[model samples]
Target: MKNMVEIRWHGRGGQGAKTAALLFADSAMSSGKFIQAFPEYGPERMGAPVQSFDRLSDEPITLHCGITSPDIVVILDPTLMATVDTTAGVKDDGVIIINTALSPAQIRKEMGIKGKKIFTIDASGISKSTLGREIPNTPMLGALIKVSKLLDIEKVLDDTKKKLEKKFRTKPELIEGNLKAIKRAYEEVKGE
Candidate 1:
């Protein structure tokens, strides 16, 4: 990984963008890295577009503001790409990971962005099959880690399972589904 990596996530209010961001940060921290995870809320309502930011570095983060230019962008809600410019301040060669069934070529053309590295995954499909829900944030986290190669997958999974166990002590299926969704997405993400 680079000295520092900034990730921006785009998703609906109800989706797990905030949770994914925090989990990524926490998991990465377990690997002995400095991290910051925060959410930017809009209207504080469900289904409303929202953004979450993460800063991961080998050194302590000195900045405490929004991430304008991200090294990586993860889109759990592809519909947000139509309304929000996910690449606003992103580097021209930055990697973009989107949860969509569409091909990377199709998204590139639709967004009128060419040459930037974009990856697409059927995270919604994976989530439906594994999580029994349409939420794709956990899966997107898998794709993010796969493409960025910042945090080790096993470490993230360990942290995730520990966290989920606290929230779902009696529900083993829910935790398993999340683990399945994440691992499936990690292996299935396609890049261009």
Candidate 2:
């Protein structure tokens, strides 16, 4: 593990990016690592742009600050590609995880992104095919875990499953489907 792992999340207001960051923080905490997770900006209304951040370290995390140069950038909404610069300020070796069907090469070429390791997953496709929803944050998080080596996939799934249990508990059939989405995403990403 590096000295620290910083993540920048881009998503629309109701896309669960903030929840994803918090869930990732909670999951990393379960791994006994110290972490900081929070959202930037105020009052995110539905369909509006928003950004969230997360930092995880083996040692106790003391710097409770917003992420500037991120080690990993997760794009939760593909539409944001035209609206925001998602790859700006990322570290040279940083990993960018995007929720799109586009290949890494295509994304790099289209976006003209120069630095960092790029990983792309059709998270929306996975979510729609497996969970019947457009929310791909969980699947994307699983891919992030695999690519960035940020957290133990099993631990993340365990913690995230618990956190999401309430919503799917009533529809017991959906639980397994969601888990499958996460696993599928973890397997799909070819990280650099």
Q: Considering every candidate listed, which one attains the maximal lDDT? A: 1
- Cα-based lDDT at residue 66, candidate 1: 86
Q: State how far residue 189 of model 1 sits from its true place (Å).
A: 0.3
lDDT of 1 by residue, 79-159 (tens): 888898878888888989989999899899988886679999999999999978898989888898899999899989988
List pairs with backbone clashes in candidate 1.
Answer: none
Clashing residue pairs in candidate 2 are none
**What number of clashing residue pairs does each candidate have, in the order they appear?**
0, 0
Residues 1-192, model 2: lDDT tens digits: 457889899999989999889988888899888888999988779999899999989888778667899988999988898879888898898889999898999988888888788889999999999988888888988888888776788877787677668877788767777788888999998544
Q: Which runs of model 1 end up more than 4 angstroms from their true locations?
A: none
Q: Which window of 10 residues has the lowest lDDT sum in candidate 1?
A: 41-50
